[model samples]
Target: MRELITKYKPVIKFIVLFLGAYLLLSVAYGGYLKVSSHYGYTPDFITDLVANQSSWLINAAGYKAQVIPHDAKPQMKLIVDGNYLANIIEGCNAMSIIVLFIAFVIAFAQKLKKTVLFILGGSLLIYIVNIVRIAILAIALYKYPEHQSILHSVVFPGIIYGMVFLLWMLWIKMIKKSAT
Candidate 1:
């Protein structure tokens, strides 16, 4: 057992750091969720906010968009030009992705200033991309409702995750440079 541990020490260290940081951040997020829930900030609040924000972007892009609130479900309707194109849910808000991004960045454990700045910048990028993704998806669904599954499941998710992958790569390069 000791020999095996010594042989894979670096891998073990990485796993420990990543899991520890992820768990800590996730627990803090859970606490935040609880506090928000206690204060009446339901999942619908986040969904509605993202839907309205996405609606603004869609409208600004020359389409008439509006958000329809739901009482029973934590979802909002994204209406574009009198057509219901998509339902905005809590998952659509990009908070979980931001949390994942922060956890990864924290795991990498850059300098204090660099880590904080990267998290802030990366979170903003993810949020903006999410809004744009929602807007573009709304437009695409309006034009070609036939390809709904591919667009929603493949293309949109690819864009967001692809961006995060790129960010992670860039962070790795930064870490390498700082280390050397």
Candidate 2:
């Protein structure tokens, strides 16, 4: 056992460090979620905000858009040009994506200041992209409702996850260049 451990010391060290960071940061994020919920920042709050912003953006693009709450749960109907496009839900808000991004960044952390700054910038970028994605998706669904499955399941998910992947790659490159 000692001999095997010695042979894979660096790999073992990385595993331990990455797992530790993931656990710690995830716990912290869970705590934040609890506090945010206590202050009324539930999934509804996030999805509603996304829906409103998406409506504004769609309107800015020369379409009359509005967000109206559904009679059911935490969802908002996206109305474009007075046509019901789709309903925005909590899963569409992208908080879970941001959480995943934070976890990966923490696992491969660099200097304290750089890592902190990177997380802030990355989170903001993710948030912005998500809003844009939602707006564009609403427009697409309005125009091409037949493509709903392809758009939501393939295109939109690809865009958000692609952006996150790019950000992670850039972070890795930056830290490597800095010898971190």
Candidate 3:
């Protein structure tokens, strides 16, 4: 048992740290959602921000776009060119992806300054990409409503997660280079 533990010590450490960070951040985010709801934020501030930013990007691309709070749920209704495109939910905010990214980075963390900076920069990048993804998705959905399933379920998610995977690979390379 001791020999096995020693052999897998790094793996065990990574798993523990990753899970801990994920849980802590998730709980904090949940608290924020609860507080935001109590304070009368219908779709929560982050989701609202993402929705509005996505709308702005869409409009900037020469499409008429707007986001409004959904009357039936805690989501924002995204409208493009006077057509109801989609609902921007809390899950669409990218905070969850940022939380997962942070947790993974923490597990393989190196220098304190580098780790903190990477986390901040990576989170911002993910948020920005997510907003752009939403805007592009809205446009795509507006243009080809028949392909909604494929666009939303596969292509857009692949784009976001693919970027995240690249970020993780880059972080690992940085860690390896610093260690050498």
Go through the candidates in order and give each one's C-alpha lDDT: 0.86, 0.85, 0.96
Model 3: per-residue Cα lDDT over 128-175, one tens digit each = 999999999999999999999999999999999999999999999999
When summed lDDT is taken over every stretch of 10 residues in candidate 3, the lowest stretch is 37-46
Clashes of each: 0, 0, 0
List candidate 3 stretches off by more than 4 Å. Answer: none
How would the candidate models be sorted by lDDT, starting from the highest? 3, 1, 2
Error of 2 at 86 (Å): 1.5
| Residue range 69-175, candidate 2, lDDT tens digits | 88755578889998988888778888778878887887778889999999999999999999999989888988899999999899999999999999999998997
Per-model root-mean-square deviation over C-alphas: 1.8, 2.6, 0.6
- CA shift at 119, candidate 3, in angstroms? 0.4
Q: How many clashes would you count in candidate 2? A: 0
How well does each candidate superpose onto the true structure, as a TM-score? 0.90, 0.85, 0.99
